[model samples]
Target: MAKKFEKIGENLEVKNIVIHQLLKDAGNRLVNPKAADNLLTIGEKEKTFLGNLDKSYHKKSSPIYGIFAEENPKFRDCLIDYINGDCQFYDFSINVMNHYKIVLENTVAATGGYMIICEYRNIITSNDLLLILMINNKEGFVIDEKSLTLDNIKNLDLSKVDVACLINLTEWVNIENNLPSERKTYLSFVKGMKEVSYYFMSFIDVDNKNTSTESTKRLITAIEAYADIEQWDRNTKINKKNKVFTYCHDCIDNKKEILLSTISSILNPDNPEHFQDFATEEAYRVSEIISGDKVRMKFLKTITYSDKEFKIEFDTKLILDNTIVLDGSGNKLTIKNISPILRDKIKELSNKNA
Candidate 1:
């Protein structure tokens, strides 16, 4: 894989700077006075402040943080350790970094990114959510609730959801001080916006009915295509052969050579720790691309071969560990060895591209 980032190298540098700066600040140096406004500000900005550090700052890591908070409280304890200086960012930062590293490795980037997005939304809602959103980035889920939609959402599986945000977008969520006329319109708007976001993020929500239709085939086609056509440098790329790839604690030995040999050469790796993030991001970029409505529509990629033309849809994982068997009925025949047909169709498409 072409390395496009070095998160640990980038973050450790930022963490060191943050701690050094935290120690220097007027109030943080004095005490953790819960009541003192200046002292409390540290905690307020602690997560967000630490957030400003990742090399891929927008890489989306909130799920990693949340899962750490949920599954291993020890990770949170590790944060306390940082406060105590038991873990130094320069040397042992890698050891302490394991806490977050574990979470990031297990969870998908979109999930983490969504979590951060939700919490940040929650933070906004903590304040008045009804303004013109003129004071942007100030409080919880800043939204223009006036324009929202939920009519087109079909009964589908909402399992792929990364986060569930309860946005009080309606005028009902407004402050009680507002007059009835102004409040009514705002409440209606919030309801609409919330519904739209809910369905939008719930990408793979396949309802049982939809699952049985041509749509199911369409959906899987969308998923695999998205995975195949992502954003990494293809020259140095090594596509995972239908298997899970885990993170390595140590740096790769031949990263530079192997990467430079192929299309992956576009990425640089002066700092090696970023390999995981880069590979994952590239996968996701491809995923989002293939998942687009137009791209997904191609998942079924209809083909013309010999005198007959048929749809050539393939999913790498759908059939595994066993041979495919053809089933026949009174008026129907199903065949399993479709590889040759698929290869031929792909070759045909290649000719067109050429």
Candidate 2:
């Protein structure tokens, strides 16, 4: 959100003047007819020129540049829009700016001050470039890459660089301070969780069958806790509960295999295949229930409460309507009902127990 630069000094300053000359020389190499016609692509040429520029001028630091070619159609279009003045500079800079910012942040943090020069080159159709300079002093500049021709380079003034287009990175200095404290904390936490999850998923994929049952149990517990907290947060009457429901429903549907396998051993102590069959059947039954179809069911034991015997009924409409409920404490409750035919089984069990 911060601008790229924070300050502007007098035009024709020594560093600016020297850098302008260096840029001109680099531009000349970039536009060389022979070099352009070489087997190496434009991107490679641009990269090579930038590499040389770093070696010749900024021996202590190297500039970074990214080339978006015809293969990268989206970025190529964005670059065209930027050159035609249809898009803002930031729009064209999105792909590379974050990486540059990260590099600058680390460099500045380590050495207390740093300067990074980078470029974005678009050669999908024709060669186009944008120059970016970032400094720790809260000042930076953007230059028209096309303006750096052999003839005009001699008269170019860097100090008078578009001060308005300058990037302000003061917010990036302490990246933690750039956003609302709570939001920043939440984002950092979520990012860390995603990184951990990525590694864990990779590990699980490698040894899914032999993965520790305890680890699977812990993962299930964590997932349940997250779901519980998220549901509670969205339980407010004004909250968009449907969005949360749809998100969770989609997640379950997408990850059904992983979820089923995770608890397969526990669900079927003796026969995992049986558990898998039951899971598949139940999934189909759930779909039918959701579609308002009266699905056939088997008898299960009835539940007795307070000395009163009650046979559970799997009335499709009732099951679907009362599938999810918010309790007094705002906890989400899922109700599973037994089929009407379970009454006879319950009576038989009670008589046998008596």
Candidate 3:
């Protein structure tokens, strides 16, 4: 009955800000500036906290804490592996991400159209081809990047991207500086992205402003639309008789009337309460496609644990917030152990599963 929206909780706020600042700051020195000053102010005794020394950042008496920053994502062949490790995901003790300064400009040069930025967990290159193969045609994957070009990548199937990503450039860049933000003549044109996945757009250095951040906030209406739900308050509707109002006079008569529309049987009463439920259902469908029950269970349970922790420690919206719903049956199953194959099976369902 409520017009649901995703809320970014407090726990993720600091890290989210830090990551953005890190990207924004790029390779600039963390000395004498406000970002540095803020850190130094809070960490008078922790000069090495924000500094780039990987080895000495976290000494026993050091105040510089970066939970899970030390994780070797290469070990996360699947999302299930990360989830299986439990609270270890939040232990940001180090920044193990590789910078793209080596080939940053070249990669960007290769891009000629609107594209999303994909932050790979571990595997970047070969995985892109393998993912394309699975999503479109198994034969589309060309592991040999020797002859690969942006044009070739454009021609390949991109429906199956398996990573954490942020989208950008929704128009062709053959002519930059001017673009129709809402519409494009191209067939691949899509507007207002509502989800995240993994894919490498290019390698960018730590000091590059072009580098994309990981966390992206999605709205409830936008999410429902992606799930193909029938009724979500996305468009601002107006009545001819009283056109300035977003809702008709009937809604003015009853405060709850407008709110009820989101869940109204007139729209789709049978629809699940949360947007993540739509995602979870998609995961189930993917699990069916992948035919891996153990993997599915592990993915769901791992997310459940993470969600629980987020809710307890930060009161932030879990990725599964009202958007995700576990049925009575799903709620009952608990996984104690999971295998890599099972994890991949989960990845086949959703990014969190992998």
Candidate 4:
């Protein structure tokens, strides 16, 4: 099977990494304090943590989307200065941590987590990138290295990423140097499931213009057009539609975004780029990455009919799975494998009528 993101972790280079602990103050409810010193060491645990984060950042289906926010460019300017050798990595990281704290304090409720500022290169493209990740630490017991005794320790939680952002330094510089491709977005970040991570966006000063609903609608139209152009049989068309619908529904349920490339691969794995090229040529306006809109996605997952007296709904997969068969001649549905409760209810109704 092909990987979800084929280019992730390819020719990746980790230049510098630093993590600072953010803790909520007990005395002061609003103020959150940072640890005395940052962890500059990149051990095996850090390596695994960074690897997972890199994959999430590059995954086209991820909720991460590109943005261009020039109104408030403080963070972007700082990055540019660092890239120009105006400051050392450690100093630049401290500024990033401090700025994050300011955003948290001024805006919504402050969150406590380990703020990781990493400078890496060549993950998705040959671009020197800086990724910032915020993750809560797990409370666990560990043997102390000095005393050789079990002590309470806080370990970085590798399972969940609370918030993250990737800054494409090379792309930004190229844009500044009067590059040709002006539509490029150098900043991309994860849109977390909750509002607590909204501060991360404020810290970076970027805005996402593309919405998930519009993208989904465009995607559906493009797929239908592509299927028609290829002259697929009715059965083949239905199967492909169901397959893509299931993929989109899963992404929405999992709080992940839909990737056009992933959908293309699913539609035509032998020629993965075939669908993408068709979409481009047809001018569908489907975004490369789309945040899954749960409300909009409901239309794709189920078939439903409703009236004053009767309302019936069933999963789209039920038809193909042979559980619910449709007869065109009779213009009715044949529902098989009825549940015991439903069967009993129908029997009771029949006995009462008799």
- Winning model by TM-score: 4
Residue pairs with colliding backbones in model 2 are: 3-167, 3-168, 4-167, 4-168, 5-166, 5-167, 5-168
Clashing pairs in 4: none
Q: What is the Å distance of residue 228 in model 2 from its true position?
A: 9.7
In model 2, how large is the Cα lDDT of residue 51? 35
Q: Quickly count the clashes in candidate 3.
A: 33
Model 1 over residues 1-354: C-alpha lDDT tens digits? Answer: 533433323222111211101011122222111111111122323333333322122231111000111333453354346446776433233332233233334333311111111112123223222110001111222221222111121221122222222222323234323634232122101111122221222221111111112222333333344345555432222232111111110101111101111112222234333332334353322211111122222223322235356543333233331233334554543445658987799799999999
TM-score of each: 0.19, 0.17, 0.18, 0.54
lDDT of 2 by residue, 237-326 (tens): 113223323333443333211234323333334664543344335222111001000011101111223436644323232333465344
1-354: candidate 3 lDDT, tens digit per residue: 533423211111111111101121224322111111111122211112112111111111101001111233331223224335542322211121222222222242221112111111112111110000111112444221222211122222223222222212222221133644332211111111112111122221111111111101112232334334434332321111122122322332231112222322223335534433442253322110011111111112212134634431111122235334345787543332457997888788897655
lDDT of 3 at 302: 19
Top lDDT model: 4
lDDT score, residue 281, model 3?
53
Q: Candidate 4 lDDT (Cα, whole model)?
A: 0.64
For model 3, the local distance difference test gives 0.22
**What's the C-alpha lDDT at position 48 in model 2?**
39
Q: What TM-score would you give candidate 3 relative to the actual structure?
A: 0.18
Error of 4 at 252 (Å): 11
Model 4, residue 13: distance off in Å is: 1.4
